[model samples]
Target: MEHTQPEQGGLRESKRRDTLQRVAQAGLELFLARGYEATTVDDISAAAGISRRTFFHYFKSKDEVLLAWQTGLVESLRQAVLQEENRQAPLDALCGALLKLAADYDSDATFAIAQLLRSNDQLRAANQVKFLQLEQAAFEALCHLWPQRRRRGRLRMVAMIGLGAFRVGIDEWTEEGGTQPFSQRIGHAFTMLRAELQVASAAAPSQ
Candidate 1:
């Protein structure tokens, strides 16, 4: 359902969301089945059981339909980071937000969406842009958690590197044909990162 989260329209009424996801699901499936360039807007509208007008109401283009699932992620992840139930360290909390997002994803569908995006140059570039937004969102969430005004630079670094680690984890997952849970891949990346840092610190020349 990557699981079909379509906050991209920014209009979160129940029916509106349902329609948006329905269209996105249809479009992504067609894109995977037929071919991104070959699939037209009309095909998606027909597949989703929506009118052409309805399709445009939710998505700007076929590409947008594939990408719409990723919109509104910035704020959602921020709120997830703020949840009271998660009492992890700052970096872990940030990653936790992302883990929560992936928790409900349909793994095969998620892999298909990733494949769809990488199948084209424009989509790949746009995908990179979305990830950049995610990094900024992570940074802001960390700032909210620790607003002492002293760790600004460090928080920014964490946000950047945290997403980097996530990218690494995702890359590894996809490379391995997505056999394992994405959260597991992400967790292992962070664990290995922390372990290496400890070893490096322990071996460092004393100041």
Candidate 2:
């Protein structure tokens, strides 16, 4: 039997990943503590113990660094949705996945991140782009649970609707000062969404 050779550059790749995470985390901290506009690239590099050139080697701008940090959650969110593959209702599965994601978030940190993302014009625009990427990720994950050709459209819809409710839920949770658990806020939003869907279904004409 032939044995696969050990992976190349394993330690170097890991060190690179660690350095990137450190820089991104540091950038987020400064953005939260000093406001996004006030935090400089040097501030993040100093916090992460890297030079400005090293920072640029990892990221183009501070905004990109922060968004890159936020993007880390996307893979986790995708995995959460995939874990719901055994559930019967696609909509319920999507909401359950969302709630799973919500439960994992630190409420205070989540609220702070929300505020940070919405604090400035550039971040706000980037946040919107991030939402679109999330929606696409959700749709692709849902397709794994229901691969039927006819179900594709509905699965796509579920992804869009689920994320929409989730976004609104987070906005409301932050607006309320994060007193409520993020899971409960998201649950309520999904409930209201289900009610609205039921009404729309009932009002539609029979085929």
Candidate 3:
């Protein structure tokens, strides 16, 4: 006799993933087509062919659906930093992870999502909140990459600088309409950061 238990579990998990993707796609389509404020949760549910209750099972709110990709990226970055095999310097690891993330976002669908956020004040504010959350999560994750004593005061500074570079790189990429690859833009941003640091160090008085 075939064991139905494992099959059932796999099928359930697959259905959940499908539901999540459908909700996200529906939300993005509505937000892009009708404007973020004009579109409601009901619209997304209807477009996704699911009940409002079913939509709520996947997302608490419309904004959550819109920002879901960023949420997942933040968690992935945290996990990447925490992994044992990522032995690069803290800033290097952060930059590498963020560059890969930017590359993932380099698509027409993602550009449309960005445009939606840029055009909507409420969505932009909500996205800022998510960015702050991502920053805090990243700092904590980076701290875990070193011993407690080693992270007492240093990891915070490194995290701040790393995040600054990431934001700058993303802004530059978006502003340029993604004409250049995001990885190259991030590399240039980091290179400029390194030069500024070097200049500052050279000008400082030797202790």
Candidate 4:
């Protein structure tokens, strides 16, 4: 029975993920078809073949359903950073982990959700909250990954730069309607940031 417990636990978690995915898919379909303002929780629940209570179990509100991808991305980035093994510079490691995430991103779903957030005031607010949560998580992970620089504020600065690049990459990708791959756009953004950093370093006076 003890051995079966882990298996059962995994199965339960898998079911939960499935339910959440279904709810999100249903919500997206309805939102796209009828517009975000016209779609209701009941509409999503019915479309997903689940009861309203079950819909609430998976998502707190309609806006949350749209932001669910952000939660997944944060967790993925956390795991990637934790498992990273390359002995590169701290900032390089952080940027590499972020680029890995961009490479594996779902551009279509992201573009669709971004469009919804832009059209709805409430969803945009919710997205801002999610962004803050992601920023905090990334900053803490960077500090842990490079403890020596944490106190001097260098890690914090690196985290900010990394996130800035990510945000700009996503914004540009969304602006293009996701026509180009997100990973390519993110790589370009990082390259530009690195070049600017190099120029700044070269211009700074030596002590």
- Which candidate gets the maximum TM-score versus the true structure? 2
- Model 3 regions more than 4 Å off: 1-14, 83-88
Model 3 per-residue lDDT tens digits across residues 1-207:
487998999999999998899889888888878988899999999999999999988998898888876757778768766763446777777777676767777777776777666666777898788667667767888777776776646777777787788778767777888777767888888888889988999999999
How do the candidates rank by TM-score, highest first?
A: 2, 4, 1, 3
| Best of the two (2, 3) by lDDT | 2
Global fold similarity of model 2 (TM-score): 0.90
Worst 10 residues of 2 by lDDT: 1-10
Model 3: worst 10 consecutive residues (lDDT sum):
79-88
After superposition, candidate 1 runs with Cα above 4 Å error: 1-18, 49-54, 84-88
In model 3, the Cα lDDT at residue 204 comes to 100
- Two-way TM-score contest, 1 vs 3, winner: 1
Our model 4 lands, by Cα RMSD against the true structure, at: 2.9
Residues 5-95 of candidate 2 have per-residue lDDT tens digits of 3344676788999999899899888887898889999999999999999999999989897787676678877888899865578888889
Task: Look at candidate 4 and tell me the lDDT of residue 173.
Answer: 79
Model 1, 34: alpha-carbon shift in Å? Answer: 2.0
Model 3 vs. true fold: TM: 0.80
lDDT of 1 by residue, 1-207 (tens): 553466633446877878888898898888889988899999999999999998888888788988987767777877887772435667778777777866756388787777777787999888899889988888887888888689889889988878888888877888888888878887877888788878999999999
Clashes of each: 2, 0, 0, 0
**Per-residue alpha-carbon lDDT of candidate 4 for residues 1-207, written as tens digits (9 for 90 to 100):** 777999999999999999899898888888878989999999999999999999988888998876765667777777767666536765687778888888887567667777788786787787777666666667777667666653538766777788888888877878888888888888888888899999999999999
| Cα TM-score per model | 0.81, 0.90, 0.80, 0.83
